[model samples]
Target: MPLITIIGAGPGLGLEIARAFGQKGFDVALVARDQSKLDALAQTLAGEGIHAQGFTADVSVPATITNALQSIRETLGPIDVLEFSPADRTLESVDALKVTMENLQPQIDFYLGGAVTAVGAVLPDMIESNTGTILVTTGGGSLAPTPARGNINIAAAGLRNWTLNLNSALADTGVYVALVAITALIGGGRPDAEPAVIAKEYVKLHAERRDAELHYVAYDR
Candidate 1:
């Protein structure tokens, strides 16, 4: 079976993505900061007949992410798909004028830095094997920025830019890269924005190996 490693795996979209890929014969490796929550999610997937294992890592700490990916490789074999979507639980939004190096740095570290670390860890193997899929998730603010979430927008935009550029860089190679920008409140009463619905897009991106980005917008922004 192929392997998919989901960074920032949680109860929402992460779980659904695990299900979508797991059902398709991909063994799931879930990475998160909370061991208990990760265990619960793995158990849930197991109940659904989807083989999943959880690894704990804090995205803000690059070393932890590197360690977790190494563990995944040792345990599940080389990863076929890498999905990165870690949540920022502590950072609070600051207006554009209030943004500073102190405030913006953490967001950058959490989103952009984390992505670089995770990709760097597994990208070598993917390139050597000549087959892999990389999917990155960011909020709509990355594409359509608002002054209200200036720091977050800046960080997410950096991630988006990198993902697009990576896609172009790997065009000649078998590895595929794409960014997923969620523009609505997931599971916020919109059937179209539900986790399961949005997750299908991830699977499609991996299977088709086309498109550099997907904007999953459920409402007018």
Candidate 2:
């Protein structure tokens, strides 16, 4: 059976992806900071008699992620799909943006450390197994450079490009690196943007798993 690990299990995207895979008979492992949330989700899936397990971890911490993935492998076998759902803010809005060199540095550091560490911990396993997927949820932060929000953008773009480069280098090795980015409000398209419709599109992007460095899932206006 194929095993999948979702690192950032949001109620919508995270849960939806898990549900999709579960429906397809994949042994899904839900990973997040909140054990209760994963528990509730696992319970719901169990009601459907889906084989699911909830694992908790702070993906930002390499050790936590390393141990967590090891446990999942032990229980469900090697991970076939590694999904990074960002327990922290994948999207940083302008309203909450505080432009400070000191404050922003930490955020940048976190993103870089988080991405590299998470990928590092799992890449080896994927290579050894000879076939696996690492899916990172990139957000609008990767679109462009920002004055206040540039830090996250910088980090995401760095991860995306670095990942693509790695993928190119490893093409003969049989491992794939991909990014799923949410460009607009995931729910709806303005007053006209229906949340359900937008979500479907977002889901499609992940399902497609395009080789593009970053896939911007946006609603048509």
Candidate 3:
């Protein structure tokens, strides 16, 4: 079975994504900071008959992410699909006017730096094998700046830009790269914005391997 590594795996979209891929015969390796939570997620997937294992890692710390990916590779085979979507719950967003290097740096480290580290760890093997899929998740703020999440938007935008560029660079390498920018509150009453609904897009992206990005906009504004 193919293996998919979901960084920042949690109870929401992460779990749904795992289920979607698992339904399609992909074994899952969930990476997150909380071991207990990860274990719970793994158990849940197991109950669903999806072979899954959890690896703990804090995306803010590049070393931890690297170590977790190495462990995942050792436990499950090489990653066929890499989905990065870490939620940083510790940092508080500042307004655009209040943004500073101190405030913005952490977002940079979490969003952009983490992605670089994770991709670097697996890209070599994917390139050698000539088959892989990379799916990155960000918020709508990354595409259109909002005053509330200034630092996050900046960092996410950087990640989005890099992902698109990487897609272009790997055009003929058999490694597909795509980004999913969610523009609504997931599971926030809208049927279209539910986690399960959104997750189907990930599976579609991997299967089709055509689009560079998908903007899952389920909001009015």
Off by over 4 Å in 2: 87-101, 145-148, 189-210
Across 111-187, the per-residue lDDT of candidate 2 in tens digits comes to 65777777788889889878777777776666555455565666667767776777687777777776666566665
RMSD (Å) of each candidate, 1 decimal: 1.3, 3.4, 1.3
* Number of backbone clashes in candidate 2: 2
lDDT of 3 by residue, 86-204 (tens): 98878868999999999999999889999999998999899899999999999999898688998899999999999999999999999999999999889888888899999999999
| Of candidates 2 and 1, the better by lDDT | 1
Off-target runs (Cα >4 Å) in candidate 3 are none
Q: What is residue 86's positional error in candidate 2, in angstroms? A: 0.6
Clashes of each: 0, 2, 0
The CA lDDT of each predicted structure is: 0.94, 0.70, 0.94
lDDT (0-100) at residue 47 of candidate 2? Answer: 83
Give the TM-scores of the predictions, in the order they appear.
0.98, 0.83, 0.98
